[model samples]
Target chain A: MVTVNGEQKNAAGQNLLAFLKTEGYEPERVVVERNLDIVPRDELEKVVLEDEDVVEVLRFVGGG
Target chain B: MEQERKLSKDADPEKDVQEGKSLPDQLQIEDPEEVKKQMQQILSKEELDRAFDARFPKEMQQKFRGARVAIAGLGGLGSNIAVMLARSGIGHLLLVDFDTVDVTNLNRQMYLVPHVGMPKTRAILQILYQVNPYLDYETVQAKVTPENVKELFGGYPIVCEAFDKPDQKAMLVRELLGQCPESTVVSGNGMAGVGDSNGIRTAKFGNRLYVCGDRTTDVGGGVGLTAPRVALCAAHEANKVLQLILQEDS
Candidate 1:
């Protein structure tokens, strides 16, 4: 079980990039944080999630 | 009792400064016209600054006196942010934009009809200086790319993200965070349409990136951009920058 944006979900065996795509976030538009540390854009595909790992995904909004 | 001296047309203004009296006082006029005439004197820059500083509380004025800020993109967000920072006496600003003002942009952007064809950098500079002549502006009319992000916005402690495209905003933020990891980047996202203005807010991404506006709101869902919401987001960005600057001194 992993916490994605405060919600408990099963992401124990998935890479960060796969999990983000499954969650409907575009890889280019979103920033991912793993366990309170920012995961660089290029490292998303390689970084994997473990049990009880925390992740936060944010995206930029344009208009102004 | 001292006798009143009669004023002459050729009175030596220098004599009043040498005397113990101020020049206006030395005019010794009961008529309003004479007082207006005496008040029309040139003031030195130091004297002008003293007058400008009189408007704000001493502590705030001191904090913003020499601090520098850089704003990227001079559309709705950047324009309002620039004006707010200038009014607060932030002292110096670096503005960058490659686009010109269009008639469509006048709806939400801080530009007049006459500025439709002018480059955004020039238009924003004119408006900012009009708001505060003491401000120092460094403007560049170039698009910000990932390759030149660090070079264009380096040296400034804080860089504001005011681009109108998601890809550009994301690219700049990613590059800025990677290159200038220590500097703060203020950005706006999700400020479209006109429902609850309160939906807009400021969110902190760790210690280096601060994003303002309704994170979920965008141009999708049949929504269109308006001035009220955009300006609110811009206000949040500008206000956050002020808070960050003041926080450093405290």
Candidate 2:
């Protein structure tokens, strides 16, 4: 079991993209910073999630 | 009083020196009176006038004094943005630049000869301080990276993306929107070496990201950036920042 945004979830050894899709979150609009390194937007699907991995997803808003 | 003066005049030179050294003991003897006298001297009319000038008119300057803005690059657009903000009385500014001033920068950077080889942050800060002594400024002497982007922009309410490199600008835009959701990020495009037709434009993408520059789709084709185009883009960005702080709907 791993924690994401303060909630405990089971990754069950699946890839990160599948888990995010299952969780109903879009990958394009959000950026993932995993373990202090930003996971580039282009490589969101290629990276796999490990057990107990901490992921912070942030979204952009429009402003001046 | 004449007799006492004569006695002091006749006193031994060594004894007079010793007694003069004990003046601090006399101060301790009547410390309360001494403190009252000191306080009275410290708070005189001239001192009060100086203090009032330093701190008065708070209501009139409150708006500009509360704004925190960050400039990503200290090149032509970044330099003009910083100067305009300082002159306009923006209270706090964060300037990030890792490049050193070079002879080539003189063409459009507005930097002087003395600033050559100096870090761009220090040069810009010195000019800003000269412009407005009360302006608050912070300098990041290194390049803005993904690791330190949040730290650099933690408290700033707005960021001006004046970076010259396309990849750096794209990364900054991504990081700012990702980390600082509440921050207003303005990006510039195609302000290089263009004429009047390639000046500046302000476009609102939704309600968060505002882009100001020439949208002529001719970026990085060896067309160098000039003063007029860069200054125009910076003015647009500055106006946008002011409007955001004033809560005027853009």
Candidate 3:
């Protein structure tokens, strides 16, 4: 199971860009980190999610 | 207190298990619902377990009653999560915290008037006893540093990270993930501020990680942590803990 934005989903074998598109992300300006390393914009289509990957889509939101 | 077992440490698990194994004996008793409804002020350990077990499916209850979970930090998130876990009949809990309860914490954390100066571990134990007296709990009142985080939380099958600060949460999550591969960490991340109550949620991260709360709402960022949101996040963590227990091998 690959975890994306803290939620585990069947994203292991997914292409990062395709996965993000399926998840309703516009892909204009989103920062995605897989295994704590940033995946560059061009690499989103090339990066295939592995079972051991931890992907977090960081966004700017206010805290409590 | 540095550390101690509270309330039910004296509870004889051998006898409790023996009595619980006699499942057929419960079938023999007539008016099970009435008996369960009438069960107030539990007098014996057997009655206590029976009342607690009545609401759960026998197999699920057995799994819940046999599991041990740990909560680190024991403040708003940890304290509330511990109480909810005990309510679910988790067999044992390892609670660790070094801070003392203050008037400020009464707003969101689980602490009473007299518990103001009491150590968080002791106060949480006092509250847990009130919720489930038959449940076993081991408490430690000490700061969890990177050096000792693994040793403190390694034995638990499910470890909940409920600290207040980002650094503490980061350190605990990082250490537990890297060092304690055997434990699943259910953490509370963005439950600060009273924004949208519905925004708080539980999500599984990776294989052995679950983080609850809105992933972005943080404390000290023009807002503050409140009771309803924090407790809601705590309940999410507690629910995830129970799910992890019942969903083993699923």
Candidate DockQ values, in order, are 0.51, 0.03, 0.11
Candidate 2: misplaced stretches above 4 Å? A1-40, A43-64, B1-60, B197-199, B217-219, B248-250
For residues B104-134, what per-residue lDDT tens digits would candidate 2 score against the true structure? 8887785778788888887886666555655
Calculate each model's fnat, 2 decimals.
0.65, 0.01, 0.13
Clashing pairs in 1: none
The TM-score of candidate 2's chain A against the true chain A comes to 0.76
Summarize candidate 1's per-residue lDDT along B44-108 as a digit string, tens digits.
Answer: 44765787678877887878877889999998899989999987889889999999999989888
Which window of 10 residues has the lowest lDDT sum in candidate 1 chain B? B27-36
Better of 2 and 3 by TM-score: 3
Model 2, residue B197: distance off in Å is: 4.9
Q: What class would a CAPRI assessor give candidate 1's docking? A: medium
Best-to-worst ranking by TM-score? 1, 3, 2
How far out, in Å, is residue B233 in model 1? Answer: 0.6
TM-score of 1: 0.81
Q: Give the TM-score of candidate 3.
A: 0.69
lDDT per residue, candidate 3, B1-250, as tens digits?
6975556667654665644322223322223233332332334668777876678788888899899999998888898888898888899999999899889998888787877887888777666765766778898889998689888988789999888876567657767876787899888878777788889887765567787889787676767878999899998999999999999767
> What is the lDDT, from 0 to 100, of the residue B52 in candidate 1?
66
